[model samples]
Target: MFMLKQQKAKIIDEVTKSLSNAQLILLTDYKGMNVENITKLRDDLRKVDAEYKVMKNTLLKISLTNVGLSIDDLSGSLEGTTAILYTDKDPVMALKVLYNFIEENGNIPVVKSGFFERKFIDQAQAKEFSALPPKEVLLAQLVGQIQAPIYSLHAVLSGMLRKLVYVLDGIKDKKPN
Candidate 1:
């Protein structure tokens, strides 16, 4: 049983370190997925700098309690082949990847709830996360919004310059130059 304890301790340490900088914690049940499918999922999450880890319920509880995180609301879902996804950056991209996986695979394992920024959100809220654009897209949108007024001001000033150009052209024609 010494080996068992050592495994648990390792898991606890891993969970603690992984969640320390994580902004989003997603819990999913990857029950029916085969090795290939799970590997694909892991690869997709890795692209977004997220990790997928399967843990024992007891160890998960111990780790969360140790790390000062509360999963009380999601405790019910910590059952039956649960795999946790921890993301320090771009939670939306990771969520979208899982959402798409579920969609493409006919929703077999099921997405439970998630811990986002210290708040426990239900599946509906998790769906909202999937609807969000990726970090790059959101940033680009914000930049576009911020630059719109400047572009409009430039266009207005250019219209006045065009009017002056027209006036000068008319004067030149009248002077026969």
Candidate 2:
């Protein structure tokens, strides 16, 4: 039908555009998830600037071509209901949100695969990536770790100077006329 064709075209356009801009693209199985649940998940993803969409696999393939990505094995995973999760920045945030959603919902949704920096990731690798900390938290922890040695050195040096000053003050106080 005309409607189906039009929808396919629109989806191809969207997916092609997404592939060009997104830092990461993730595929998921959203079979048991209801519309309300999907809406909530979309809201959660939006809060962190990730995009979520359900699209036809054929359209996805066409779009993949536009973005110079090809997958020969995607047919197996493309059988069921499929949705894409993506972000232009902070791939880990998008993966984390999806992982948390699945964890909270007892696996109502499943991660199929992901593409990050032109590299494809299987479900297990995607899960591992998601298990890592968020970018900001990881950055903050790294900064703290890097600064800790400097802070300790400063404290030690200051303590020694303070002790030397106190020793000089004590000698001055005890000086005989």
Candidate 3:
């Protein structure tokens, strides 16, 4: 009995640490998935610096409370074969991996809900979040947007300088030597 209590305590502590460090926490219903599929999913998530953990809903609720998140807000998500996908690194990459895995596996394990950026998101929101492009791609798009106007301005200035130079040469040639 004492050993069981100790194990539960250890699990709660580990889950609490994970919750505290996670930037994105997605709750998935991993029912009807075989061990092979789950292992594959875990491997894919690990590639993107995310972790997939299956935990008891009660322990997860305790962890959420320990992490200062209101359990009421997430009560609905903490039900039925909860598998957590969590990451402190690029969340979009992790999401992409999960969604891709779902697509390939005929969507067996469904995303129930999620907590991102300290906000609770429903299943639809989690799907939308997964559809987002990776961080590097978004960063590149932002950089392109920022540089477009600057490049246009440089081109305009260069054209004006070229015209000025041409006019100056014409005037000098007409004046003599």
How much does each candidate deviate from the true structure in C-alpha RMSD? 3.2, 3.1, 2.0
| Model 3: residues with Cα > 4 Å off, grouped in runs | 1-3
Ranking by TM-score: 3, 1, 2
The most accurate candidate by lDDT is 3
Q: After superposition, how far is residue 38 of candidate 2 from its true place, in Å?
A: 2.3
lDDT, residue 58, candidate 2: 71
Better of 1 and 3 by lDDT: 3
Tens digits of per-residue lDDT for model 1, 11-65: 7898988887788888888889888888888898899899887777777777767
Assess the local accuracy of residue 134 in candidate 1 as a C-alpha lDDT between 0 and 100: 76
- Give the TM-score (vs. native) of candidate 2: 0.76
lDDT of 3 by residue, 31-134 (tens): 99999999999999999899999888888888888988777777778887999889989887888899889999999689988788768888888888888987
**Consecutive 10-residue window with the lowest summed lDDT within model 2:** 70-79
Let me know the TM-score candidate 1 reaches against the reference structure. Answer: 0.79
lDDT of 1 at 174: 94
The number of clashing residue pairs in model 3 is 0
| Reference-based TM-score of each model | 0.79, 0.76, 0.91
- Clashing residue pairs in all predictions, respectively, total 0, 0, 0
Q: List the residue pairs that clash in candidate 2.
A: none
Clashing pairs in 1: none
